[model samples]
Target: MQTPLQFCPRCKKDVAFVAAAGARTCPECGFQYAVSEPPNPGSFPDRPDRAGNPWLQFLTIAGIVVLALLGAGALLLGILFVGCALAFRG
Candidate 1:
């Protein structure tokens, strides 16, 4: 039986879901499968969306830290300029 078309990451095209062995099999490469069952199916999806991705979280925190550092540096520079102007004022 054929189901609605799903996004195929490998094939990079929408393909109908082919129910085989209680998993969604890829109709193109025939290698990847999306096992939507339990009891140790032991198969992974073609396009894995890992929610708890450590690398992604780490990169996001790193980006925020970098932006914070840049803002602090700019603030320090402005304070130094203002202090220098006040000291040299006649």
Candidate 2:
């Protein structure tokens, strides 16, 4: 049995597909493609752990800060509108 040759996008040539150690590499330009193993549904983890991802935490904190600032601005505007209305009435 022989594996079908695939077109190499980088080299722009037809090359034989070779697989070794869960990866496919192009012979011409050395382009690598990782072969992903299918996850076992029964053994899957309950939840993804994001504690190690600091960027996501930073983004979440930044979003909360922005929302808080926007709420403060809206409250300030409301207070100013009430003050202007009271002044105009008097």
Q: After superposition, how far is residue 86 of candidate 1 from its true place, in Å?
A: 2.0
RMSD of 1: 7.5
36-78: candidate 1 lDDT, tens digit per residue: 5542356534434444477997999999999999999999999
Model 2, residue 48: what's the lDDT?
27
lDDT digits (tens) for residues 7-82 of candidate 2: 9899989998676665778998999887564333545333424534689999999999999999999999999999
lDDT of 2: 0.78
Clashes of each: 0, 0
Model 1, CA-based lDDT: 0.73
- Best candidate per TM-score, number? 2
- Residue pairs whose backbone atoms clash in candidate 1: none
